[model samples]
Structure formats: structure tokens, C-alpha cells
Target: MIFRQICSEKGGSLAYVLGDPVTREAVLIDVAENHLTAAEDFLRSRGLQLRLLLVTHWNASHEQAARALRERWGARLAAHESVHAPCVDMRTRDEDVLYFGEESLRIFHTPALTPCASIYAWNDRLFTGHTILVRGLHPKLHGQARVRLLARLCALLERFPEETLLYPGVENQGRRLSSIEEFRRRSQHGAGGDSADLLQRYRHLLPNKRAAKQREKARAEKNLHRYGPGQDVPASL
Candidate 1:
């Protein structure tokens, strides 16, 4: 099995690479536009073939990249029906299990269809698309439906083992990994709670004006490596 966490410098979004080393079949999750060069180099080096280019959510930052990568890799583009991307070749549904070689990924549809639209589970990791963060900063979602979403998120977190790693959509504090137990403990969300209360408590969650400024500052800061393992690949769109 081959697994990697890639951070796009443009949006600071997290992209993932999951592959069956034995079969040489791979999947790219929310890969970025600037990520193409490195991805190609790595795949070529490993002799891996991309079978699926899966988007947990169709965001502006990744749309062009996804399309370009699909064309370059000739991999099938997969997304939820709600995404409405004409480029998408596979309209995945909730609980849909997609297979590539000997590996499989189970998709779980979430409320926010733009950023945190879906969560994909592969092995012990959960690609939580923007729905989760190690900082316990769940995306600030409007609409009454988020109440249900919060309750559902709590339930989802409960179902997974404490050790299960969470690979969230956006980068948090330059980190790319967390766990169910660590999230529950650090985020101040205990076992179970009322959705309404959860909303009230975390209504101001996600990025605020201050956070945006922080990100801009982080953008100025540079990384040493270009696109090696665990490298933060920064580039403009």
C-alpha cells in the first residue's frame, strides 16, 4: 500500500495519494494544479498508474487541476452527484465503495457540497474534506440543516476507532494529520451532544478575518523542498 499527504501551496489545501503498490493502481484525491509536476514525477518513478481521480468536493481551487490531471493521467474523474461538474466521469453516491486494484475507498456524503461535501475512508485514514480539522475548527456552515450535519458528524466520529487518522481538506497550522481521539479531546467535543448546542457553541468556527490574515502571512513563508515526500508544494494557480 502507498499513501501520501500532499499540501498545495496556492490554497493550502490537502491532497492525498492512495495506491496499491502491488497492482500499481492509484487514486488522486483533490490533487492541486501545481501538484501535477511532482505527482507525475513520483508516479513515473514508482511506475504507478492512476485509475481514479476522486474529488471529495468540487472547489474552485481544484477544478482546473482536477481536469488537467484527469486529462494528463487519463484517469476517471469521480465526485458526488451534487457536484454537478461536467468533467466528472463518475457520479459517486453515499456509501459507494470504489475499487482500484486491491484497494477500496468508501465515500460518505456530507451536507456542505462545496468544500466539505464528502468524506472518503481508506485503510485507517479518513479524508475528511473540510468537514474536520485538528484544531477542532469545523467549517462554519449556515442553514438549519447544519444542525443535522453536526449531529451526524459527531456520530461519524464516534463510529471510527480512536486511532483512525483524519486527513482534512484544508491545512491547519502546517500540520496534515490527526486522529479521532485527538480530535474529540482537542476540539472540546465530547462523546455525544445535541446538534443545536453544538451549533451554538461552534457557530463562529472555521476561518475568520484574523485567520485569513494568518494564512496570508503563512503564504509569504517558504518551504525548502519543492515536492518531495511531506513537502508543502507551494505555487500560484
Candidate 2:
């Protein structure tokens, strides 16, 4: 088996390509349009046929190129069912196993980033899309459901092997890869939580209810300025 990491410098998104040497069949995970040409050329040069194109999650930053790639390459396109788009040829579920010629990949559903967000693990490699970052976790972006997802991910990591290699989404000045053990430790030490709550608690170490109220108050004030007085913006809307 062979692995390739494709990094998008703009959003710090990472895509992957896994290939089987014997069958010369390859699978692409979360490729971006900007990197598509290069990825395809690299695979072709290796005499690998692009068989399966799987998406870990459907954030615009990661999936905008999926449609184009599928159309151009005629490969089977896969994604979480929540993507709810015709572009997806395979609707993936948690623990769904995919075979790329000889290798196997397991999908782990993690709603931390989105309802259908997930990570893909194969062998000792885990392609964690945007669930965790090296610099810090994004609580503000994750919200409430994300916290629950992170906790689950933390637990799942405990079962992973020590040799697991993590390719995180965040770009930092230092380390790039992480082990399951390392991530587990961080999650236990407050890396896993409601992103907004974590930020608020870290800022003042106050209770969630109080921090939430403060967040609402700040939002009200910000919106008041944007739309002027008496233009109450419903929080849900």
C-alpha cells in the first residue's frame, strides 16, 4: 500500500490518496480542485487506476472539487449521507468498510464538525479531516454537538494502536503528525468539549450557563449595531 498527503495551503485542509501496489488500484480521500490535476498525474504516473473517490466530510472547502473529479474521472464517489447531493455515488455510514483493491478502510462517524463529519482509518493511518488540530481545537466552529463527538472520538482513540498516524487539518509551525495516544491525552486534558464552551471556560473558567449568557449578550450587541435599534434578530434565525 502507498499513501500520499495533499495539503491545501489556503484553508490548511489535507486530502489523501491510498493505493495498492499489486492491483494498481487507488482511492482518493477528500481531494480539492486545486490539487486534483497534480493528484491525478501522480497516480497515473504510478500506473494506478483511480477506483474509489471517498470524501470524509462535505465541507465546501473539502468537497467543492468532488463533483468535477467524479465527472472527469468516472470513479465511484462516496460521502456521508448527510451531504444529500446527487454527486455522491456511495452513502457511507459509521464503520463502513471500503476495499481499494487489497487495502481496507474503516469509517468512523464523528459529528463534531458537522452532522455527517467523520474520519477514515486504514491500517495505522487515520485521516482525521478537521476533528482535531495540533495548535488547538476549534470549539467556536464545533458548537454543542461537536463536543459530544469529540468525547466519543477521544474514547475511540484509546482502542487504536500506538503506531496510528494522525494527519490533522490545522497548520502549525511545529509538529504535523500525531499518535492516537497523544491525541487521547490531549482530549482528556480538555481538548474535547463544546468548542464555544471550551473557549468561554478557558477565557474565564466560568460555568457554561454563564458563559452562554455572555455570548448571547455579546451577539445581541453586535447584531444591534449591524441592523440598528429594534431590529431584533432571532437567535435561531
Candidate 3:
């Protein structure tokens, strides 16, 4: 597999280009407008055919690339069904596999960041998006929901190997990657964050059904109020 990690000019953002050596077929992950040219350049330089654009939840930044790549390279855009983007060619589900050449990446639904937020894993590398950051996990969810997110996230991480690599959607202190083992080790000591602190912080909190529903409603709005192909775009777009 061939891979390249592109960082934004101002720098917390990140994007990636991964290609299959055998087929020269590639997929771009979590791309943003700032790095689109750089990403496109790499594809051109390597003579790679962009097969798909897989988004693990980057806000509006993703829209630009989705349109550009689809129009220019004929690449399909895949994302969680709840992702509100007209350019999306595929509505992915949990455990769905996307193939490019001989390589594939599995989708893992993780909606705490946003209803569409997800993670993509291939071989031992995880394109974690905001689900699992390189610096740590700090999702802004309602109390009980936060608890559930932590639990589910832990359960999800456990499914992968300890040495599995994590490529975060956003960079932190110039640190854009970590392994499952490294995240856990840092958590134990408190230098880098882990679910432990989050668990402890919210352990005493009680569930607020009302607040949880309100949060869900807000996310629903994002999905409902977006544009779809050849349709009258929603006001939110």
C-alpha cells in the first residue's frame, strides 16, 4: 500500500492519500479544501486513479473535495447515511467494507462527534476522525450519552489489535497518529488522555433523558436540512 498524510497550512487539520501498489487505485480520506490541491497533486504525481473519497466526518471542509473529486476524477464519495451531503454517492453502514485495489477499509459507526461521525480501519491502521484523536478522546456529549460513548468507544477499540495505528482527523501539537497501545499507556499515566479521566469525571453524573433527546434533535436537523443531488438545496446548505 502507498500512503501520504497531508497537513493543512495553518496545521491542525489533516488529510490522507492511500493507493494500492498493484492497481494504482486510491482513496482519499478526510480531505479538506486547504489540502485538496496537495492531495490532487499527489494522485497526479503517482498516476493514481482516485476510486473513492471516504469521509470520517470533517464538517463543510469535506464538501469541496467531494464535489471536486467527483466531478474531476469520477471518484465516489462514501460516508455514513446520516452525513448531510448531496455529493455523497454511498450511504455506508457499520461494518461495511470499501475496496480499492487489493486493500479495503471497514467502517465503524461512532456518532458522538456528529451523527455522521465514523471510523475507517484497514490492516492495522484506523482513520479515527474525531472519534479517537491522537492526543485523546474528548467528545462533547450529554452526560449519560457521554458515558455511553466512552463505553462504546472502548468496546470498539478493543476489537482491534493493541498495536493498531490510529490516524486522527485533526492533528494535535503536530501529533497526528497513535496506536491503541500508546493511547492506553498514556492514559494510565495521565500525560495523554484516555477514557479513564472521562469515565471518572462523569461517573457521578446522572442521565438526563431530556438533554439527550435535545442533542439528538439537533443532529437530526443537520441531516434533514442539507442538499441532495439535483434537488433544491436545503436552507442549511
Using TM-score as the measure, the top candidate is 3
The Cα error of candidate 1 at residue 168, in Å, is: 1.0
Of 1 and 2, the candidate ranking higher by TM-score = 1
Off by over 4 Å in 3: 139-142, 188-237
Residues 169-232 of candidate 2 have per-residue lDDT tens digits of 5555645677776765665465544344554444332234567789999999999788764546
For model 1, residues 1-237, the per-residue Cα lDDT tens digits are 897777777767778888898899999888877777767777887889999988777777578887787777899988888777788898888899999999998998886535338889998989887777666546565555555565566667666899999898778778778888877675455322324456666666422557777887776554423343453544643
Higher-ranked by lDDT: 2 or 3: 3
> Of models 2 and 3, which has the larger TM-score?
3
Residue 29 miss distance in model 1 (angstroms): 0.3
Candidate 1 vs candidate 3: the TM-score winner is: 3
Per lDDT, the best of the predicted structures is 3
Minimum summed lDDT over a 10-residue window in model 1 is located at: 222-231
TM-score of each: 0.75, 0.74, 0.79
TM-score of 1: 0.75
Across 1-237, the per-residue lDDT of candidate 3 in tens digits comes to 799999897867888998999999999998888888899999999999999998888478789868888899999999889876678889999989989999988899988857888888888799888777786675454456656666666668778889899999878877889998887676556544345566678654534557878999998977775533435645465
* Whole-model Cα lDDT of every candidate shown, in order: 0.75, 0.72, 0.81
